[model samples]
Target: MTAQGLLGAGVQLVLVVAGAPLLVGLMRQVRARLEGRAGAGVGQPWRDVRKLFGKDPVTPRGTSEVFRAAPLVTVATTVAVVAVVPFVSTSTVPEPGADLFVVVALLTAGAVATALAGLDTGTAFGGMGASRAITILALVEPTLLVAVLALSVRVGSTDIADIVSATLADPARVTSPAGVLAAAGLALAIVAETGRLPVDNPSTHLELTMVHEAMVLEYAGPDLALVELASAMRLTVFLGLWSTLFLPWGVATGTGVAELALGAVLIVVKIAVLGAALAAAEVFVAKLRLFRVPELLAGSFLLTVLAVVAALVPA
Candidate 1:
């Protein structure tokens, strides 16, 4: 790879790492504002991470190596996924076969690690959370894949970079009805994937309602910080991917410095808008009950399948 390419990739990684916390904080702030309360500063997440990192590690007696190892896997997967994502237009970081499908697989790998770690603790809440997480993931993965396939059909490849490049080459494709449908499907998938409202609430600690939080109830210290940072990174990566694909108006299409700079600015703006929308969603919607999750995911699946068919088949 060229030195410039490597530099660009590093820039993307650094950007995601540095911006993840801010994005999380923004979401919290927006949600608070929507609720007619004084919002915490956008730096709140950074402070929380700092405090968590300085605390001592706590391991439950029933926990195994998997619990110790999960934070590492979670953080690593977030970094890896961010690198693989086509942030500045269609450019990918140096990695072998890290296409869209591979991206999904890596994400699933992370989820599996988390679920296993949750169950390893042998706590009732942990076991319950893991089981629910598994079911949600099982339903969400197909919806995600089908939503991605909707875009892939028009672009004729499942590689994320190729899809972005194709979309850039013909901007009008964004206005296509199939494109609109795909965007809707992907948006729903994003909410479901990220554990947002009507899916899972990040701010909730109630054991009866928590899905992701219940699994992490035992984590503390730097390990908890890593998990929190990883979750933030995951949110950023997914939102970035959505913007890169659907609203890539200012993204770079060629290996040029000016184009890259513009792409960077546009990406920032897109993410900011998306973050606000997510926060707004969280504010207005309540978390679904445990049993309601399956129906929600199933509806997403049907919408995604329809989107794919709309893209590939003749009207």
Candidate 2:
């Protein structure tokens, strides 16, 4: 790998690992203020994670190794994606893992591991959460794939870096009808995938409505910390990917120190702004009924389909 690629990868790894929780905290703080309640500062998530790590781990009896391993697997997969995806710079390390399909597969593997762990718990809540999570995943993965594919069609490459670089070269592509539709579809897919509002609420602990938190009810201490950290990282990664794909104005095209530094700052700003906007929007909306969730996702899928058609057919 070239020095620039290595530097880009290193920057992404450090930024995602350190900034993910802060992003979560910022979103929470924004929501809290909008609702007229004092909120914990942005550093609260960092404190919570640190406290969880210091606590003793717990493993319930009758649970298999899958239960113990799921958090590790999830974190590992996310870390792998951060390493390969061109989040901070397009001049990233040359690797086959940068392929869109491979990145998608890695994300899916993490979800599957978490689902299996939920089943392994043998608890009713765990099973219920696992089933719900899988159902959402079933709908989400296709939309995500097709949405990105719509963008790829124009560039004729499934490599995320190539798509970003192409978009950079042809700035007009971002304003096309296909681009608008794909962005809408991709944003919705990310919301569902990250267990955000209307599809699933990250802050909810209510048994009937909780999808992700339900699966992790059995986890405590360090295991819980890993799971929480991974969840935050996934949200950040998706947001970062979204910004890199659509609003790629500031992403580094070369390995120059100045370019990389600016890219890092801009990405962090983009994600934070997006996170705040999402939180603000959530304040005005309520979670949908379970059955209605599919309808919402299906609509997003349709948008992606239209995006593909729009991309393929000449204007």
TM-score of each: 0.95, 0.98
Give the Å error, residue 56, model 2: 0.7
lDDT of 1 by residue, 174-276 (tens): 7777787778777887787778888887787988877788888899999999889888888898899889888877777555777667777778788989999
Q: Considering every candidate listed, which one attains the maximal TM-score?
A: 2
**lDDT of candidates 1 onward, in order:** 0.81, 0.92
* Regions of candidate 2 where Cα sits further than 4 Å from its true position: none
Candidate 1 ranges beyond 4 A from true positions: 92-98
User: Per-residue lDDT for 73 in model 2?
Assistant: 98
For model 1, where is the 10-residue window of minimal lDDT?
89-98
The numbered model that scores best in lDDT is 2
Give the Å error, residue 111, model 2.
Answer: 1.1
